[model samples]
Target: MGGSTSASPCSSYQPSPSTVPFQRPPSRFKDINKNHVRLDLNSMVSTLVSDLGSVDINLKKQRSGLLKKHRDSQYRLVELQLVVRFPCFTMTGTPPSLFTMPPRRRANSVRCGKATQVSGETHRVTEKNGNDSLDICRVLNGMWQTSGGWDRIDRDDAVEAMLRYADAGLSTFDMADHYGPAEDLYGIFINRVRQERPPEYLEKVRGLTKWVPPPVKMTSSFVRDSVNVSRKRMDVASLDMLQFHWWDYANTGYLDALKHLTDLKEGKIKTVALTNFDTERLQIILENEIPVVSNQVQHSIVDMRSQQKMAELCQLTGVKLITYGTVMGGLLSEKFLDTNLNIPFAGPPLNTPSLQKYKRMVDAWGGWSLFQALLQTLKGIATKHGVSIATRCR
Candidate 1:
């Protein structure tokens, strides 16, 4: 997905981690006369594991039903590889610490350890025409990793990771025009799927690509040409979703651009959407009768500016939200918890574009100290619920 940060007034302090011990209260202090409740951590963990297993089974059943329906309708067969992987576990349902240490690479594999076994659910969004819809994974595999500063991503490894995610049911991917080689990488991965997997599984994969164009005259040919380029790069005859982004709303040309994109829906595009548009411009687009299914925006626990107005307007207009920065470029995880956000780095600096972008958001949200407190509270909740801090943040 594309990257952007929100600046809004927010709290500067958050509750610290619940340090109150998990032990039962003393008999003298207990309210025996009234009803009492107690929680057992072990039992909660067991239930969580059971629920996850049930969800996995249900997802498989759903996939099977969908595939059958597609075949009955004579739609193109898109086969999905069903692979099972084991989940990581710890005795206490939490990691050893809240600090992310530097990664230690293995000689044979780019990934440090076994892949985690979590799958995203799928949802279908109907287009404005209501004649067709797109099924997308709730958790989109973002391709911003290809952007500079994270690390040198080997092309082969990146394609392998895409396959791994697809096998795990994360079939929807989000990429953009500016993200380096992201579209080309998707083309390679899809070609691999076509060559190796069953034809039925091909329809399960969806790529939601973006068009971040410079503010200029948005002629019919210009819009068609840009979208055709993305389609060629991704090796798709028709794009699943084409999200248009404009840097400066002052130009007043975005309307013409979106109109032209909407005109192309008859051919190369399936659904047209928006990215990083505020409520005001979104209103303008809607008033112009543009058929937008969703708006990609920066939304997380810390930054809630969207909820204040954008969400309400979307509710009224029936426009859904595709959120990014939910984990703040991994800063919301335990790795950054309790760290000195102000001091210079003892090791390598925060080099990735995502880290640099979200660090500024952390500072604007209330600096490092407040964020640490939030992380601590999140850790406590995650432990009680038998999930990782990263999962809780998401």
Candidate 2:
């Protein structure tokens, strides 16, 4: 909320809109092991428990009814997967669900290999024809992770990192109209790409952003203005993709917003995407025949809730799932590795209200004890594959 927007500071907080590649002197010193980049997770957890030892884990309060059912199914699927493979746990008194084996992270075994040049709307992700040809990097650039205080990002360094990622063939972008100046930053990068690269090369960069309006009455002018604001800030004449989000469904002004947005797309504003729309509501949108290409949602090992139903639904609707929170705010990585439940974490204070909200989620889904088991399980998997636990989530 601590943004330049005239609204609540945290509510509208914007970071430096996309900066062309950031320029920073490369550190000459030995690089810290990527696996252990943050402060000690174990110590932080201990301090945290000492401070809020009596605090209850906030799990069930914030999510929609649709999310719970979806998440339950995913958890059950995982349980079934584990039971089939590790009958030992099932034979023991403990059920597979209670076994608490952390999900493994094998960095070398990601399904997506290095992508090559884009030929058309679809690019060949692999040499094989039928592996997976998702052209828009299913995982777009995430600015939300930068919003929370889980890590300290050097702005200049971060910009340079973006350049590196783009060079590596991960060009599709994932951002929100409200994610500070992420859209603006993407715009700046695109302009630079247009100048430095050939026209064909420049087309590889596609940005997908969201428009999250308060649940309220929507008019054509209001919707157009919202898109215009993003266009002006991002300095783009046409948005490559526009995603939409709303806080309350009961209000139902979202329909009006979507109708107008689809009009923008028809007008060649770019593709339309959705962020965090539950499957039921998503179905409603599709039932009405609203066109959308992707739905951005929180999907990670701990939150495989998306897999419960979204994956199947996506297959049915031909929509792709662009996921975030797969890393659990870095809590899923080595930062929390070997961390005991008693310590509190120390990182930059969170600016996005969602961080605080999600911390409550960490409380639920099995508190520190359950989380500890998950982490231990992940550690085992990480060790098996020779990669950090973080890479597994990625």
**Using lDDT as the measure, which candidate wins?**
1
Tens-place lDDT per residue, model 1, 1-394, is 0112222322111111112222222212112122111111110000111111111112233233322222234322232111121121101111111111112321111111123433423122233323435666546778766644455667889899999878866677898776667788899999999999998678789898878777688899988988888888889999999988775667999999999998988979999988778788888999998888877766555554555466657656667667676676778777877778567784235666667666776665445665665666666656766665666321
Q: In order, what is each prediction's RMSD in angstroms?
A: 21.1, 14.0
Tens digits of per-residue lDDT for model 2, 8-87? 11111011112211221122112211111111111011101010012223323332231222222331111101111311
How many times do residue backbones clash in model 1? 10
- The lDDT of model 1 is 0.59
Candidate 1 local Cα displacement, residue 110, angstroms: 30
Model 2: number of backbone collisions: 26
Q: Which candidate is the best by TM-score?
A: 1
